[model samples]
Target: MLPKGFQYAGVYAGLKDNGKKDMGVIVSERKAVCAGVTTTNLACAACVKRARKILRRGAAKAIIVNTKYANACTGKQGERDDAEYAKIAEKLFGGPVLTASTGVIGQNMPLDNIRRGAELLKKELRDDYDAFAEAILTTDLVVKKISKTVQILGRDVTVAGVAKGSGMIHPDMATMLAFITTDADIDRGLLQRIIREVTAISFNQITVDGDTSTNDMCLCLANGLSGVRIDRQALPIFQAALTEVLIYLAKAIAADGEGATKLMEVNVTGARSLKEARLAAKAVAGSPLVKCAVYGGDDNWGRVIAAVGRSGARFDPEKVRMNWDGLQSKTVTINIDLANGRESAQAWGCDLTEGYIKINTKYN
Candidate 1:
């Protein structure tokens, strides 16, 4: 079930040639505390630029999204278009709207179509989770969403998230597009801090082709509908629930990577620091050679070792040890030991296959 104070809607705005649902919005029953993490690419999209500014206000009533025209690298007009779209949404659905978009990077958004979509969405808002999840996807094979309820202050506090990503997925700020909603009352600064910390170990740990998108972002809203107030004493429970939702969606994105047949997980332990462990884990997971070995079931452990060595993590080569689950399964895990200290980290990616080559050759 969705969080109590939120409503969703998805409709076709003619941005996509396939006539699929390409536009969506999530509206909270009242003003909600909002937090967001966005792409670090210098050439990021207009939506990312605008959302960064809006997130600082720490409050919003709705989020409007569209796919099939990223509105990136389009010059000043793109920024104007993104602002205009938000204005249209605010005009119809009230004030303080955030926006997100994905798809081809250089095209300008169709303002007229977006206006029509906003008008339709005004009358279509409902609790149809699947519809909004499906609308945000581009190359994803299936919808990715999760909901969990935790006990907080003797009340049921719900946290829910939905994500969309298939290609151009790597983490600098956050990967692709994800939206989270919670019914727990939370401070805006605390919510932002939690999002950043969780994203580092979740979305920031996944890779698909190692190509970070120009429009990547993750946003969270807390409307306090559950009447459960979160303070330092109760923060752990709420953060843990949010972590579960984000990590589930992250793994879903990796497993659904374009033309990928299996998920590959890398675990690194016994490092001198968490940063070093993370560096080692991500190095192995993002290595195309290691991914190809997993795809072919080649059992080539040398590639993994080579990646770790070049990963800039300090560790003695003689102390390193490796183990692997059979590569033939739908999920493969690689275990490694730096044998240096107690720090550890994990990363996720998908096996590289010939299908990947085929899909990208005509991606445009």
Candidate 2:
């Protein structure tokens, strides 16, 4: 289900040879309070820069996205192309626009094709959520989306989101694009705070190939059409609902990791601080040896222990405890007791397999 007062469309404009949808647009009837978290990588895409600038103004009316040609490392031309696309979209949608692109880096975006795509998208505008989801995917095998309704201030508030990612994923923003929409009224500052906090526990706690991409980003738009004001008293409920939606999409991305057969959940407990817990959890999740062991269904607690030991988190080895109660299921959970403090954190990932190598190596 889509949030209120928004329209979506996805159309092909000669970007992909296979005729798959390569461009998508989401427009809100009213200017929406927007917040976004983007790739921390130094070689970020031009669209990332543009989006950040637009978001700093505090509101946006639409988001234009394209897949199959990340506008990264193309120098000034890439930046100009991004601006051009935004201009085209803003003119058509008649409001401020944010843009995002994903796919192979170091290539120039085909602006002419994208302009054509913008026209097609305008003509195709509808509530076709699935088409928008499909248009943002590169190597993902399935669509990742979620929707939930919560009662806030005696009003029904809806939160819906869509995401696309399969590989080149890691913490500090994975190689993915996610757009979250809501109808609850939230202040810009509060919305930004909630997005950052939720991302730390969700998108920032997942890994696929331990590589961050240049075009990764997660954006949230709140149009307040539901007439539900999320004041301080109602923040907790809204935050919980947002976190649930993001975590569901994040786990879905991990579970659908390229050629993965199992979803791996790493839990680090007894840490001295939240940072240490997150470090240990991410280390365990990104460890290739641990992932391979999980793939082969091996009870190799040693790999998990080794990952934690080198994670820069101080802990006594002898006092550490390991559990693998999830071995019998497709979802494997590895629990680590650091025996250092009371804090705990979790990270999600996927098992490594030979198929992963094949898919990446053969990818054009």
Candidate 3:
């Protein structure tokens, strides 16, 4: 079940030509503690710019999103349009609205369509979680969402997350639009720290394409509707739940990437540091050669080793051991032992296929 005190709505706003739902709104009954991680791409979207500002306050009441026009690289007008979008959402939902946009870059949003969409969203607002999940998608084949309940201070707290990413995904602040909500009362400072830490091992551990998108972002809101108060002692439990939700969504995004037919998971161990372990795992997972090998069911173990060598992780070639399992299945798992230290990390990615090229080349 979804967290309490939250309502969702999704509607078509002419942003997409096929009459697909392209606009979505998420509102919390009251202001909620909010934390966000956004794309580090220099040319990020206008919505991302506004989102950063909103997140700095550590509180938010609603989120408004659109798919199709990324609203990136559109100059001053794009920023103005984002401002207008926020004004409209704040006017409807009260205040402190986060904004997000995804799809083709270098395009401007249709102001009229957004105005109309806001009205439709307000009128249709309900507890329809699926609608909100579907409306945020662009090329994603399925909706990504997960919910879990945990105990905090003798109360039942819930955490739920939804995400969308099919391509242009990489390990630079998530590389997708992910929204997570919870009903636990959490210190905003602690929540922010938790999100950043969890993202490093979850969303930041996945890659679809080597390119990070201009509109990537992840937002987490805690409304305390469950009456569960989280203290330092209970932080670990909440963090684990949040991690599980995000990792599930991350794996889902990798599995459904563009035209991917298989999921690739890499495990790197015996690293001198956590950073090195992450670098090695992500490099292998993101390597086009490794992905193609997984796609073709080839046990090209050398490609995996080559990726690690250049991953900026210091390691001895003689001490490294590798194993590839399930290469012929829908999911391929690779294990590597650096045999140098105790640090380890895991990364997720999709097998590269010809269909990926076709989908992107024909994309408009």
lDDT agreement with native, every candidate: 0.88, 0.87, 0.88
**Winner by lDDT between candidate 2 and candidate 1:** 1
The reply for model 3, stretches above 4 Å from the true place, is 167-175
Candidate 1: pairs in clash = none
Clashes within 3 Å, all models in order? 0, 0, 0
TM-score of each: 0.96, 0.96, 0.96
lDDT of 2 by residue, 199-243 (tens): 999999999998888988999999999988999888899999999
Better of 1 and 2 by TM-score: 1
Q: What lDDT tens digits, residue by residue, belong to model 3 across residues 88-111?
A: 989999889999988777777899
Give me the runs in candidate 2 sitting further than 4 Å from their true place. Answer: 167-174
Model 2: residue 74 alpha-carbon error in angstroms:
0.5
Reference-based lDDT, residue 259, model 1: 80
**Which of the two, 2 or 3, has more lDDT?**
3
